[model samples]
Target: MLSTKRAKSVEVRSKPGRIYTVLTTLGREIAQGIIPAGAVLPPECDLESRLGVGRGVIREAIKTLSGKGLVSVRPRHGTRVLPRRDWSLLDRDVLNWLVGQENPDRELLLAVQEVRSIIEPAAAALAATRATKTDLLRINAALTAMEASDSQATATAADKAFHLAILDATHNPVLQGFRGAIDTILSAVFVVAVDSVDGWFDGNLPNHATIARAIEERDATKARDAMEQVLGYTQTHLSKPKAGTRRRAGRTGAGRTLSQT
Candidate 1:
């Protein structure tokens, strides 16, 4: 249970925006399992007293959370935290809250990678056949930015842009519509995966360049294979090692280099 003092401590440290503060506080607590799923939130009056917020503010916060599938409310019963599977995991705020945790959920991270494996390779294959000059330019530019990036932040952004550009090159609205979801997932995963391994961004540069070059050459098969290789690096980095296993120096598992087919 979040005590009045603890809630107030969060409130004081929060930014000036009241509703956002309450929302983020509650959301973080939920994501961290501080407030576990299937638990009922305190009454609005209790929340108002605890967080020092108005009734209206609490209501609005709950409403927003409900929209994000974090909780469900009923007139007779109080708001109940829904199961993790119910969450709008792709929602920007929700994804940020989850990723921001001290130890992010491993399952969620793996799930994001699985989603990428299913989508990006096909998108790259399509881009190889359908990409216009402008689309190719954007993809190459993002790849160049990745190679030149001086910091992790820039590298992550450039990497995300490179993948999104391929989706755009597909010229399929359904695939294009995935941009927002893809951006959200990539933003979260890159922060975790890239930071976990030193030189990860630089190490993956060759694979990214291969993907771009394959697309430029209009080689759908090669583009798809290259994209799979890129995702293979992701799977290796994100996967939990067995108790007795160890990663080899200077290579991902299986002695695979980024540029290798």
Candidate 2:
């Protein structure tokens, strides 16, 4: 029998390869609640046959799940799915799998926005007070890229970059760590927000410039206000339906062109 240390080492050093496939498929299922908490995973041999992988691969996959707090493995009993709270909620793959659910988790989305409301306003205020010329240049460059983007996809990416640039301007390591959580939700919300409102980016494109200009002027209050407006627009546009359109939570609409801006 392999020692626990040896098993973990093998799982980590080996290319994941087939194990990644199994982990993603099963991990997504677990994240989506298809395999609910407390359910027992299939026996090793059964998983091997079902997933078309060797015993070693099965063991490694189980170990991977264990590390994520998704399952608890035992010597006699089968691996049991742990409670959702026990899972590593911040793990990238776990979050991605959660994103795969047909109905995106609104609560989770709102939670991220709440954190943004708390962190970004302060970060923008600090940036306004402390940003150097080079920092301001990066922020303006991102704004320019956003304006020049040809497609909604490109615009969304540029929009994220603009905010990340502001975060970088703050120059505080502890606050910078908050970015990982924000990044996880930014894309999800951007896609959903654009889809929720007609010409969303067209109406909001100038708000990012508002933030950049305020920071350039070194007006802490204006910078904070501008960032709050940007986030407020995100919340309002995502939460409320378009004037004539009934609420379409997941519909992908034809977004307005950003190239003309």
Candidate 3:
């Protein structure tokens, strides 16, 4: 695991890789909406000082940005940020790290969830119409692993694999685009919130079974609804305050255990 200090030092490397790192950091800032589109970048000298690199390194990083369609360089003029669509979002590495930046914005989080809500169900529906025998087997393999896992961490990884398998069944280029969004959002949410929730893994067996059965039956409607129901139930279960914890109890005059209340 890269510690925060080490991660921040991504620019300390040499030559080709160093320029790539600098471009990636600046690109990340642009994607996260810190460096607004069409905003003029600082002069090369200032950028070199701020980025703690040589002037040549700054020039190389800017050249990389231009290559990536992130910046416009003119004749004897300054560099300017380009539109977001021009940036290579299809670059998986960009999407992977961009979503896990220091703090993802609330709007970005909602964008990811909204994309999932739209795409995952559609993918499941398409999979119902077109999945191969091997696709079903792959998904079921993850299901079996999830069912057998006793540890919270292993169960969560199995859960991720199961969803990715569902996406793999779609066989449509467009529907297949949502896999990374799901992975990054869930990873970040698990780190920041879900991993700390009590009873998150305890009641999920039945939920998992229901989802697996729907997929096995190749029932699109059932699979879609079961996915939504599982997500909703898990959210509600995890949202409750745990018993004997210092969280302010409601007006019910009793502090009930989360699942018991």
The lDDT per prediction is 0.79, 0.76, 0.64
Model 2 lDDT tens row, 56-143: 8888777898998899998788899999889877666676777635456766666667778889999999999989999999999999
- Candidate 1, which ten residues in sequence have the lowest lDDT sum? 252-261
Worst ten in a row by lDDT for model 2: 242-251
Error of 3 at 30 (Å): 4.0
Candidate topping TM-score: 1
Candidate 3 residue 171 C-alpha distance from true site, Å:
1.1
The lowest-lDDT stretch of 10 consecutive residues in candidate 3 is 252-261
Runs off by more than 4 Å, candidate 3: 1-16, 31-39, 45-77, 81-98, 150-153, 203-205, 231-261
- Badly placed stretches (over 4 Å) of model 2 are 1-14, 74-77, 100-103, 241-261
Model 3 C-alpha lDDT versus the unseen true structure = 0.64
- lDDT at 136, model 3: 85
Candidate 2, position 110, lDDT: 69
Q: In terms of TM-score, how similar is model 2 to the real structure?
A: 0.77
C-alpha lDDT (0 to 100) for residue 258 of candidate 3: 18
TM per candidate:
0.79, 0.77, 0.66
